[model samples]
Target: MMIKSLLRISTVKVLILLAGLMLMFAIACGGDDDSAGDSAAAPAAEKKAEPTVVPKKSVHEEAEKKDDSAASGAAATATVAAAKKDEPTATAAPVASSKYGGTLNWGTAPNNNHVFFQQYTPGAGAAWAMNIGDPLMAYGKGSEWLEAKSMAESFEVSPDGQTITFKLKKGVKLHDGTDYNAPLHKWNLDWVLNPDNAAVTRPQISAIDKVTAIDDYTLEVHTDRVYTPLLNALGMMGGMPFSREEYESKGEDHLKTYGSSSNGPFMIEEWIQGEKTVFAANPNYHQKDTYPYLDEIVWVEIADEQVRGAALETGQVDVADINSKSTDVIAALRNADDIFEAKGMAGVRLSHHNAARAPFDDIRVRQAAQMAIDRHAWNDILQGGEGHVYMGSVLPPTSAFAYKVDEYMYEYDPEAAKALLEEYAAEKGLTLPLTHMDAFKCTDEQLEIGCTDLEKREITVTVGKGAANAARAEFEAAAFNAVGFEVTMDIAAGKEGPRTFVTKESSFSLRGFGVRPHPAGSMDSYMGYGGYWNNGSYGTSDAQMELHETLKLAGQAFDYQEQVRLYKKCQQIYLEHALGGVKLANAPSYKFWTTDLRYDGYPDFTEVFFPSDTSLKMYGMYLER
Candidate 1:
């Protein structure tokens, strides 16, 4: 009875949370208003059109709100030490004991949070909600998929495997004064399937049909379908329980500011919007003495990538974002008096194209795009040789399951691209006609004119199949022009920039450059042609669509042997016919982290201080001298 009362958070923000805001233009990015079943459900179309959202402030406005507007490294260190200033900090089940305290500040390229991600306040999103906040079952930095017990003292999975029960560690307290008890902390996965929550919850708990708590420390989860990675998901923000008092106070997009923790190793003491967010170590943090090596963290957001690079070089910031777009930054860091450091993760790019469209509406067109780009050259230039090129629809070949069969899409042939252009032209019927959006491949000056302008829509793409977006834009412009077809490459900015053409299906074809969630071994990633990512909306060759369910089920199979068998089958699916969006070169995921802040996953800073964290697990991370 006590548990139910505490857990009963009024459906205060539930209405606003009708769907997710993972995409920048969450409502605009989607196609339909009523299709809630799709993970990224479209917003109900507005009865009256709304004006575009213009940024009233700078990208780093929130970070600038802090006291340490210029340099934050010292303030960040003070954060860890600040945690000790509260209560003498303790060691418990989740966070193993260690006596390190200091604040760590970090930055994200897209340094802001949206509505769908309100509950998750980390830089990346809900994915890092664990250690910094709460992990129903935290992933001890070292363990892969195996959740390290945190707020949960110990746990047991039901014999049927659909349900998982957790034993709560005693005397757990939220960053707020409220204490955590069973029913309050307990939530049913079934809520995710509820018609009310269905559209919003589909992406997070697709495998979960129900959740129930038998006791305070024990939970029972029942799956309508076989769910193998449910535990891993539990170690994420989706599984982190919300505080009743804290959740209801924020306004409009208020949920995004629901800042209070139940069991993460660190506690965000204060968030000075546009300045710096201060994260004090959690005195009651389960990981005793081990947490938050520095004192209080003063996380500042610097919008200009160049400025961020400069900050790190001058020690104004400890770490910053790195990826294909930041080649110049990487070079500067490497050349910086050995003071700068960088690390990268390969095989991380996924191609997103509308399944129900022209150009991409044809599988051959999609294949041509995959083969047109000089992937290695792009990686060599942008990723600085740290990147890996992949034609297959999976991570890298390093994994046992990635389909390394016939190296199908590696041919960077413009000739072939030219041939595919003819097929599209022949099919679409060209009356010596050219139609295109003037927005794409345009300089900032050209975009002001808009895509529909009949006069300036055509462009001469000189860079033959450039790299990534540049390559894609050039190929699209070149392809259509070859056959006297018109082209449109919409380059909108803000959340809607890249997808401006895609949402409207206007570009020759678009690449949705975002990474969706999936454990390393899961083959059903958006990259792989699994259910939600089935390319049906973009363009699925008949052969590729047939393997949909096979890969989906194989993706969930906990049995290693069965999963391997299905993976082999799924790879064949892609090889037979290129899916609508073909895998180009995986953008190298980079992390330039400080050696002092210890944690898992190479410089993931969502939890290091406080901003937006979906899943945060602090382990093996202690401050160095």
Candidate 2:
């Protein structure tokens, strides 16, 4: 899949120096109860960042497309490039923009069995999401938000602000045609949160306590409390509505039952375990005439990103999401006459701290680690100019919520790093060899391609005991090296880290991209909504307690600007406390579409066609020669 941003992804082969991050990091902004509270003190700094409620309704296609176009900023690029008509490359219609859609066969990691809707498959999720679900609101080319129409045409906030009413678009139907009951062709109002339905994602809606339908086109949701972003929250991946009748009856085969029906632009037809998944246009699909211009989209989840790139370069696939870490692949496909590539930065940055025993607990150790990173050197030598430099924090500079701070953040100065380490050691009786740590990562194509590329630049590459014992080994190595103590790392998927080893403070190991809820950009998740962002998931502090209470009432705080202002101030408070974790970099969200297809609605980033987010706006997306 052509993902949204070109994440500095290292195919397990490249050593990611303990992939960790900051406010700019793309943690899950996903709405999980676990992310309900703030943990530790935030680094003394700043930043802030949207909402909604609808019982249920079909999504509007045009608004989605329009918003996508705005996100890509493609139109601006297109208009300018149009002026250079003399150049064939600039004048010719974009190959990717050409219209076509069919069953796309794709592949993904074999064990992606996690059922939580919040936990979406990265590469696989991108291709499947547009077809399977609808986010509350989306931005298109030019970063335009399309909310005037669709499933949630318009909504109203309640008097006490505890309830939100949504005016839906009538005539919405479930793909399976399973309405609430017989003789009553109404949509079942119970499936959204009733875990009794046993739907895999029922837990996500657990917060909604109750649901009421005012009329066919109007839905009302009564929350336990007045959550400001409720409606918009429903538009997210987790908020996707599921049909209770469908799940209740077809519970026997969950995937077959759910996968068989989608009210979106397309319907998935087949899933061949291990090889590929294929998709086809949904005849009854709400946006039928508008969609799937081509007949199908096949995604082959190749573990090896290099192989994926190889496939693209060799024409086996029209396009592929190349790893930013795989410089060779980038170089390979860029030079290939048959292929052309575009590069964008992911918000994800890399940072690790000394959060163990004495020094890291001292903050300066983390400062030293932050300072040791030669920003220019890392990008220049390892990145090969493919990515850019960023400071600690998950709130990217581009986001509207990030509060601009006056501090320099931590910078790369081996001398500064040494000084901080020395100062802390001298003052607190800390020792040398500050335990450097990172999470254990799995070995896949990304690693091979990245390692192969890095090898060209004279960097040492080694596949340390591949995923299994990598975490333990990494921690042991780092801890041991920290003086005579054995320092090493423990590698594991983001999920496993917390359940088993999260609070082992002295023996802490770092992991990347799990601290946030869904997008990882939400104020609650960052400031500690649930356990995440708090003392490493469950760590508690007074500052965090203050922030959590404020976020709850931010809805009534004057206007949207003032509401957001409060969140910003809260972020600064968290920062001053050093919060639970240090964000290294933000991972860019990349969305890839097949070259044979044309549509509008994508995220903000560079796109084959320009939309502010480079997302193809449904209205703007059309197959053109």
Candidate 3:
């Protein structure tokens, strides 16, 4: 990814000098350090970067014009150069003026009533909540900073780091025409913290001791201890506040019976369950200047990816979420000139293992299981060589806290896997059931791949199948051998299924952790005793405990260098213990948007694309006249 930032010439000069000296030493000693050489030579290697020129025709047509390997290499080189330059070499088309009025037609998968408060998951529901409800804090689009000037004007952390004070944006009105004040904030917090609600956001704010309304617009949130990801967590689903009046008057089932009552830029005008949800601009929104350029936003449920793509192509829908499975759609959209744009961000796909169970409890068995499957082949088969192999770490290399340790990556070794499985079978004969949820189209294929390899190793593997929820339930009940699922740091950190697994209510399961903007948010959720995904009783080994401690220290450590060092240590510990389950492959989440949708502040299309947080805030989004 090309980061837009001014180049520091002085820093580059120093880097060049260091590189030159290293090259001299390497040549003098006749030493071969290809990786080291590449890193050192990167900065000084090029004075200017060449931009990747997307062909005017289809990708397939473009591929036919040039040598496939050569073109790919050039693109890779150009990408690295652009990243080093911290700027886009190609000139982007000028963004047109944002015009308000038209209804933005959006398509999404079925929500199954999870779009309501307290029950909403982080998938599609969180994305909807981001636009419908206001958060106390927000993350900057494609930026590392946490934006505090949203729902809350300012915030203060106590010197002890246990208390946080927030001043609400004055004059903000909820969808129900009630004033948004400190009491409302406290009310939302109380509801989430209430065990009766069983809110998924509970674990995210579990460290908070209490929330109190200091004044009409002032709120105080005190934590039991120093919670590191508190601010980031607040920027997520946990921070969204609902209308108190609607909840109280309409009753507990109001959200389900009626609709969303939020104080964001938009309010639910009408919701035809399973069909569509229509939202109109909130007239009394706090951020009046950016209240909403679109007069109405209609979110239609389109389960089929191909159908969603077709809708977007035919101008029936303005935006849709497309995955790797929608390869033809993605290619078609990418080929379309100014009509459509497809953007993808790398996320992890994993096969979760049950560390608490007998065969998986044995480290060798786990290693064999991981080694049996060829991740490269999986990527080729599933993603068409578009995915990157994810090592054990949840954080991508772009993150500051990411570790450079690759020794933990289990290489595809069928011989070693067969030997290990044979040894295990000789010791104790067992039939392992490989399970997968039917929701993910690739799950069956992924399981089959693993099962086929295991069968070759003389290991009996049975296929267990069911609906997504049913599979999850069966896995939680420990009725199967290994269950396959998709996971993210936020989901794992929540109080739902991942938390139950962490609590040792369920045994072994396979899952993936996608790449997150920040490492701590995801890492903390799966690391220590407090982690939502740490079955502390069953999976907490001595090494895992040490890793947890290291992560905790990293969270508290203010020094950037110290934090990196601690995170590195934690990664080492994780790899040593093989606590990250079995990592498979990471692929970019492909999302498409119509070119007609113009965003006010976001001049670049890439700025508004975030698949992880689903933070494509529609407040400032407008249609181009």
Error of 2 at 352 (Å): 7.5
Give me the displacement of residue 279 in model 1, in angstroms. Answer: 2.7
TM-score of every candidate? 0.67, 0.65, 0.72
Total clashing pairs for each candidate: 80, 183, 6
Instruction: Return the top candidate by TM-score.
Output: 3
Q: Pick the candidate with the highest lDDT.
A: 3
Model 1 TM-score relative to the real fold:
0.67
Candidate 3, residue 173: how far the Cα is off, in Å: 1.2
Task: Give stretches of model 1 more than 4 Å off.
Answer: 1-99, 114-123, 126-128, 140-149, 188-204, 249-252, 258-262, 270-276, 338-342, 427-486, 497-545, 594-622
lDDT of 2 at 358: 37
User: For candidate 2, lDDT tens digit of each residue in 290-309?
Assistant: 55465666656566766777
- For all candidates in order, the CA lDDT equals 0.42, 0.39, 0.52
Q: Look at candidate 1 and tell me the lDDT of residue 4.
A: 23
Off by over 4 Å in 3: 1-98, 142-149, 406-408, 425-511, 514-517, 533-538, 611-614
TM-score of decoy 3: 0.72
lDDT of 2: 0.39
